[model samples]
Target: MQLTRFTDIGLRIVMRLAVAGEQPSDTTPMTTKDLARELAVPYTHVAKVVGRLAEMGAVHSRRGRAGGLAITDLGREAQIGWLARTLEGPGEVVDCEGSQPCPLRSACRLRGALARAQRAFFDSLDEHTVADLVRDPTGAVLLSLSPPPPAPPTDDAPGNRHLPQHR
Candidate 1:
């Protein structure tokens, strides 16, 4: 019943960028590393989530050292409810589907009720945009965010997860 971390990160990415879109702090577009540091998430995670947001048309990105991210018009106007729903996907709330099978698969009014509730949740979220979430007129939200503790160095770099530890 809880939102997935992916959805959470997706929201954070869009909201952070939308807030930053106002020229808070560094006005230039933020790279994944910058976002990861600002949001207190892993760089790999931010990179992956950024790709998802880009695919969803919530943000745009560039490559190379100059590569960075920026929220799009869609991102700024994104509805939290829609973002949650879209990121949550069309899967069943309680896994009442086949193959694995659920005891309630045959007749589950709970599923219908859950669906209705989910719709209502999104309906409420649709009333607000990403901008609505940022109420700080002084842009304190951007300024107040603190960096996370440093990540322990990992030898498991991309495409090298199978590599033997050199240490």
Candidate 2:
């Protein structure tokens, strides 16, 4: 269930930008060389993935004296969604509702367990915007990239009543 290098590198590039936020005028637009230097990835590899992300509207690239890359809102959102899906094992899980039944269907608990866990994972992610991811890229640096935590229930009353349940 490992993420493809393409997705992995693209996510790294986005994280770098997210962490960088608004680029400093002194900091020239990041070239593939700059990304390579900072992230330790080869320029060629990063370029392809980065280009793909741009094609997908996940990034915006400019050409000229200050030509470089920056994150777009769409790119940021796509990156966050991409990371969430990858961490949850992406294509490795089957939705079991109508697919071919596995031989272990009668005994395998992993499927149901993972399905419940995946739903919860996505539910938690739905609470976050890409801005959150940009702010906390380091939160995942040396640790596992788990799903975002479920947001604490909001207090809506003087007695500290929880917010209304979401459907």
Best by TM-score: 1
Which stretches of candidate 1 lie above 4 Å from their native place? 21-25, 137-139, 149-167
lDDT of 2 by residue, 108-153 (tens): 8988787687666566656765656656456346123323445675
Question: What would the C-alpha RMSD of candidate 2 be, to one decimal place?
Answer: 17.6
24-134 per-residue lDDT for model 1 (tens digits): 456567888888888888889888888888988999999887778888899889888988888878876676775787887678788899888878878888998887887
Model 2 clash tally, residue pairs: 1
TM-score of each: 0.80, 0.54
Cα RMSD to the true fold for all candidates: 6.2, 17.6
Q: For residue 48, what is the lDDT in candidate 1?
A: 86
lDDT of 2 at 115: 68
Backbone clash count for every predicted candidate, in the order shown: 0, 1
Among these predictions, the greatest lDDT belongs to: 1
